[model samples]
Target: MSDNDSQKRAQFLAAYDEQLRTDAETPSAIKVIVQGPLRLVTFLNGRGFITYKNLGGADQAAIQRLVPEAMAYYQADAEIIRVEWKTRGHDHAPGMHEALIDNGFIRDEQESIMIGEASALAVDVPLPEGVTLRQVTEETDVRAMSAMQDEVFGDPVSDDMAEALLRRLAIDPGMELWVAEVEGRMVTAGRLELVPGTKFAGIWGGATREEWRGRGIYRALTAARARSALNHGKLLIHSDSTEFSRPILERSGLLKVSTTTPYYWKR
Candidate 1:
């Protein structure tokens, strides 16, 4: 990376760490419970999320106290069976990783935080013959798409994911569920979350069938979503991308700002 590109990435990381992550999270949660410096978010279907800005500059002793306390907050609720503590690479909280591990949180693989101008990704991408893309809203289509995504990711079909998507659709119309289908069968799917009151829209869960990989369908789907985000007045697109999707986003002009690792604790 050039010096200017590195500086730009640093700036984006700082803005994202301080502002976008927390501000965007609050509006999406069904309930946000604050514990000291942490925001304990309760999502639909018994999922819990723990995050905070800079851990409020906590020292080692403070981090040790806060880590378990946050986990305890989730454990207190019978509905919350799983909790993920979202960590950023740039966070300065001492012994945070150790604290989470000691408290029974299992670490998940890290992902790159990709950000870029929405307009940069709004270019046209040719789709394969007989493949069609469109936004989906109905529960039947939503469930089908979710199941397809689960199968693509090597996880069993999750009713919870389908239910959560339906619930979110009822409350938040800003969310767009897009799918690419061949002859009416789902082949690719993803979600675009337009953060209300922010310049960012997040593209998540981009999954394509193994047989359909390398056909430019995923890229076309991303472009379609980016066009929609731009139409809705968003200037930037962000995603916590896996190895598979990272190169696709980079091809669309997004820069890797930082890394995020989610440490999960199951009760």
Candidate 2:
């Protein structure tokens, strides 16, 4: 990478760790319990989250101590089904990987953190002949969108996820749920979340039906979300992208600043 590229990646990484990774993840939490330097966030839908600004520059011994301390806090919560300890590749967290594993946390696949200017992604992308895109508002449409997404991802349709999304939409006007449909049947869906006080809007949960892949429909959906972000005055767009979507986002000018891996502990 060029010097300028390295500098830009460093800046993006710093801002992400400082802002979105800390505050954005905690705002919607049902309760935030702080243990030492970690934030243990409990969500309404039986999910627990753990994060911190930095591990206080802790050494291996400190990490070994801190991991279980944070895990114990989540263990006390009966409602939590599983907890995810989010790890960033660029962070200087000593012994975090080993510590989490020792505490029964299973490592999941890592994703690249893609960051770019929203304005660059707002350009029009031509859709297929019969596909249409729009922001969804009604309950039926939202539920349908969620079902389609779950099916695309090979997960069973979840009523709880749909209900949680509806509750979130009722309160957060900046969160936009979008989908693409063919002949009134949903084929693709995603969410564009505008972080209230930040310069970033996150594009998340993007999924397209198997039959709809490779026709640039997902790209069109991304452009739609990017347009929404631009309209909301968000300059930057962020997504924790899988291999399937990483190249698409990178093509739209997003840079892979870092990688994030989630370690899960089941209760």
Per-residue CA lDDT of model 1 for 1-267, tens digit only, reads 989888878877776775575758656587997789888899876788888876778899999999888887788889988888999887888999899999999999999999888999999999999999999999999999999999999999989899888888998988999999999999999999998877889899999999999999999999999999999999888999999999999988999998999999887
Q: Would you list the clashing residue pairs of candidate 2?
A: none
Residue 42 lDDT (model 2) = 88
- What is the per-residue lDDT of model 2 for residues 151-231, given as tens digits with 9 covering 90 to 100? 988899899889988988899898899999999998889999998788889999999999889999999999999998998
Error of 2 at 93 (Å): 1.4
Full-model lDDT for every candidate: 0.90, 0.89
Cα TM-score of candidate 1:
0.96
- Which clashing pairs does model 1 show? none
Each prediction's total of clashing residue pairs, residues at least 3 apart in sequence or on different chains, is: 0, 0
RMSD of 1: 1.3
Q: Which stretches of candidate 1 lie over 4 Å from their true place?
A: none
Displacement of residue 141 (Cα, Å) in model 2 is: 0.9
Off by over 4 Å in 2: none
